[model samples]
Target: MTDITRKQFIKLTGAAGLALAGGVGAPALADTFLHKMVRKPIPSSGELLPVVGFGTSRVFDVGRSAEERAPLLDTLKILYDAGGSLIDTAPMYGPAEAVVGDLVARLNSRNKSFIATKVLQNGKQAGIDQMNASFHKLKTSHVDLMQVHNLVDWQTQLGTLREMKQDKKIRYLGITHYTDNGTRELVEIMKQEQLDFVQCQYAMNARLAEEELLPLARERGIAILCNRPFGRGALFNKVKGRELPVWAADLGIHSWAQYFLKYLLGHPAVTAVIPGTGRPDHARDNVMAGMSPLPDEAARKMMLDHLHGL
Candidate 1:
């Protein structure tokens, strides 16, 4: 779609060559679309993941009624239908983990979903018990990515997770934190631990990770997942009622959501940005940010300067 050769496109998306040229796990609806999401390699194993993913934090804790779930169903449909994966959820996000499990089961998309959930309890056995509940709730035998949420008893949790990985109960394990103050601890853990991923808060407005976490993640070969890419919606408030910058077309951005998300995707260390949403339209817009022609350094600087102006 961006005039890229098929080989280049494969390279960009980390697609598995011509075998998946048609896209291996792509939803049927995606066959008609030419543009697929760009994928970044996981620094640990070199496996690729689309750079835009869905986050379920307070957004997916919905009622059981079909009326309430109709929109969320459409949201997941739009994501996988656009060749996107990587759904980040945590047991702490109320019903989000269960909701995701239920919705994905209803859609019969368990294999299609990249399930990443967290264990938040403070002790090793408590963490194991919680993770067991997550598996039962998510209805999965092997989780794709499991995390130690907010680093709560992270050392113990990591040890247990390593055992799970050894037992094939989980494929990969990582660490996450939602605040800036936690970076020092996170950095220390990253330095000493063999983690597969690191989830941290980062966005145009929240660049605390850029000072150390991001670079350190790259140095350590740990994949980075950015949360709060919208600065917890403060970014939207900043651009409220303003027209999208015309030059955004140069970077393939069509909406402020894409603009904000593209800024995160442009960072070298980011494997994906999991923006939580229950709306189909919002999910669709978020996925577009992972397509080709992301902003370069100069354009990212320009975009940041514009945000500073606000």
Candidate 2:
């Protein structure tokens, strides 16, 4: 096992006083996240993207303080070096958009990011203005994807996004739904709209998306972006004392993060999962899940069983 030191990891990641001292070359294993998943087409432009992404929610809300953001800065660089680039954020996530913008701008890796953010607006101009703020903060000419935050005021935001999409200011458009109520409503809108993506919650414990939401997304061909894949740290808490199962070796899961991530990733309808991270070690563990052996139908069922047994 690689004992990655705090200082050394930071150095390797180019964050302030630390570096990537060891574990730079992680071993290959089965059941790793990237075993067989391929990019799916956007339908509108036939663009293909990897099935894993990073969420910048509470972790990326470090505001303008460099000290509060130093670790996050390193995490971003680590993500880029590790070949993981999809970053999801929003104006609601405090200073998340700004922090991501500042850090990536410094690294000039903004181009490498699959930038996605949200705007919560009750009015048309408020939506437009907030999105413009997002663009300026993210330091990008156009965001890769933009969603109406939490599907709130979709009546105005959805119409506004469709217009913006036609203007080419954003590459993709959709709405987000985080609550149970929002899920039902958003699913119906997705069935009726010509959207390219949808952001929502999905995790082991919260299997609400599995019932009808994810299935419908699969049938409709709308790319589903999973938010709170870590369930806001609830999954980690649940597995606190549990060691990585021995069978995890057969599946190539060396960490609990991989265990949870692989289960969510095993879903065929899932386009990408965005797990938030503030520490580099946790970030690496999360990215490594993208390289796991994908569970087939039977294996997926087994995974569910294993998770419940936890």
Candidate 3:
């Protein structure tokens, strides 16, 4: 497939028209909308990742039924067909890891994905045991990335992850935290720990990361995975009845979701933004945020001011 430029992709996807609940209304375009996945490099290793990644939190905890698996299968297909790769899940998210593993396998796309799962245990032996179970749930000998969830026993877990990395059981090591309480400690770890990635919450409403954490990550050469870029959908409530600002199209943002996500992608430190959803069209819309140029300093300020004024 030939790679399409940002404008070309927007034009292609935009022409498919819109659906209120999901994304493009055209099902045929779902399979052939465009062939580009915007990529950013892992600061620590120069490894490239798609700027738009999927998160499986509450969305993938489904029972083993054909009706339940059908939409997920389509979602993965749309993601892969659009060139997306990263699929972030954790043992904390109920059966998400297993469900994701099953869906990707059903789609024959296991090799095409960059699976990132987490270890949330506290002790060395327990951490080791949990991670082994994660591997089993993911149905993989090696995962693309393994993270210490919420910095829980990070020292022990990180050490275990390091050994696993050496053993090639995992390809990278990271740490994740979703609240401000952990920011200070996360900053200290980024300064001292040898980490490949850091996952945190950073949305327009939750801009705490902009003050120091984001800059620290950039300075330390750590890839940042931005979670809850939409403020867990709370930001949307502020703009419930408002239409997208006319200038949004200039940045290739056609929907509120894309606008919010594009705002996050504008930050240089953000390697990827993982937004959780179970709908295929919504996933398509999320990935489309990566297809356009990010906001510049002036545009970013305008976006902030506009949202704040509401």
**Which rank order by lDDT, best down to worst?**
3, 1, 2
lDDT of 1 by residue, 1-310 (tens): 1233222333443422112222323334455246878999998889889898999887798889999899899889878876787899999999998899999999899988889999999888899999999999999998999999999988899999999999999989999998888766788899899999999999898898998899999999999999988887677667654666778777877667778899989888889999987866466667778889777789999889987886
What's the distance in Å from true for residue 128, model 3?
1.0
Residue range with the least summed lDDT across 10 consecutive positions in model 2: 15-24
User: Deviation in angstroms for 274 in model 3?
Assistant: 0.5
Q: Which ten residues in a row have the lowest lDDT in candidate 1?
A: 15-24
Ranking by TM-score: 3, 1, 2
Identify the runs in model 2 with alpha carbons over 4 angstroms from their true place. 1-40
TM-score per prediction, in order, is 0.88, 0.85, 0.91
Where's the lowest-lDDT run of ten residues in candidate 3? Answer: 13-22
Evaluation by TM-score, superior candidate among 1 and 2? 1
Better of 2 and 3 by lDDT: 3
* Each prediction's whole-model lDDT (CA): 0.82, 0.74, 0.83
